[model samples]
Target: MAVLVVLLGGASVAARLDDSSSDSAFPGRPDDAASAPLGAPAAGGTASDAYAFIATQKGGSDPVTYDPCAPIHLVVDARTIVDGGMKLLEQALDEVSEASGLQLVVDGLTDDEAPEGDAVTGPDRTWLPVTVTWSDPKASPKLKGDVAGYAGSSSIERDGHRWFVTGTVVLDGPQLKRILDQRGGRAGVRSVMMHELAHLVGLDHVDAAGQLMRPSGDESITTWGAGDRTGLAAVGSGRCIPY
Candidate 1:
């Protein structure tokens, strides 16, 4: 939803890797309290009651969107993935597709190895495919603190349409693993994955609490809320491109 949010620069890979090992943890706010995600929707409470939309920009002017006529190809880097991890991601993607009226197909595993504290831990170049990988804070600085995951796409103007040619989803392996290892952690992990996938489909964080796009993780909101479903449907209804 947040077009060109600049989660991380593709070119910053080299530098980030060099200093990744030493990058200090960006702890969540309120040392004594857990940090919640920052997203769209809901005025005063959680996202459950609120819904918001994200806008995409084309040439810094017109709004652009991904083609709804085709399936979104997704490839997973399973090198460090835990057993059944890919299953979870796929299921979550399926849910998103159903809600958005989009199709998602798993293209299988990527030959790319797990990142070694360098880059964004995704495809070497843009327009390759949506790449999903499990990584630590070293590979994703945003994972250092309360952040659970991140997702974004690369866009290209094609046939008078702004197409999201490729995208990336990075999960906090260590943190998520720890949560998964604990009681009721699987639900949390799945919720986080769903939230990130929503981002991939052009949903941005809302200010509400009950919504799935909440910046702060809410395990209870396992399924898509009304607002989330609305945004996803809209994103999937974008103009179709003839690529």
Candidate 2:
């Protein structure tokens, strides 16, 4: 309802780090201009009294640096019998991963066939991909059952990476399609997943209308600009503490 893919972008965690110098910031979300304040500081210094994770506003001026968790895998427990917009969301996520510099590996594990033991990663130097358990509107009314997704459990200690995102993101294909339709196709879809995945990596909303972290939706500026790249790089690999 209220959104923007959050903000920023970065390098391929899979890339040869030896070649790159540093990534960048401030891609700006589309919706920031029409609503909320920008670059406001947190109330006092207490973390508990801090602002909402995803907010109607943003304050801090200094950009979040890029340091993402590597090998971000995904698990898609989509319906064996796919439905409308389902395939679209999946394809988009993969494309976004490539564009955003995150390694999103999806697994096709059903709720029943879900691993008996290792939920995140197993001892075989492998982990439960992205743990995607699908559901529709009949199951989740808010999403009209059209929503199907999952959250990475907190402290999923598998491999060198930890579970950065600990919540479910119901990226409705209809809402996504409608909002993105204005901007064309691939570009719109990329924006949606890119924003959500950034949240997965621990990015907060930004106030800069020109920054990718903005909350309000904007279609005119479709691609993740330099600022968006900066924000995304910051979220991907870092000292993550998922609450």
Which candidate's lDDT is highest?
1
Q: Which stretches of model 2 miss by more than 4 angstroms?
A: 1-70, 79-101, 109-128, 132-138, 141-153, 156-167, 177-183, 239-243
- The lDDT of model 2 is 0.39
Superposition TM-score, candidate 1 onto the true structure: 0.70
TM-scores for the candidates = 0.70, 0.48
The global C-alpha lDDT for each of the candidates, from Candidate 1 onward, is 0.59, 0.39
What are the per-residue Cα lDDT tens digits for candidate 1 across 1-243? 111111221111111222223423211122212122112222231223255444455455322445565567788876557557887887897788777766667879887753343232233332345778887788667767666678766554444455554567887777677667756666667778888888777777776756677667555667777777767766666665542
RMSD of each: 13.7, 14.3
Candidate 2 residue lDDT tens string, 1-243:
323332222111121111123221111222212232221221222122111232111254322322233344555555432333445556655534543445455544445443433233334433234444344444435544222222222233213333332233434445444544554555554555555555554455555554434554454445554455554443332332211
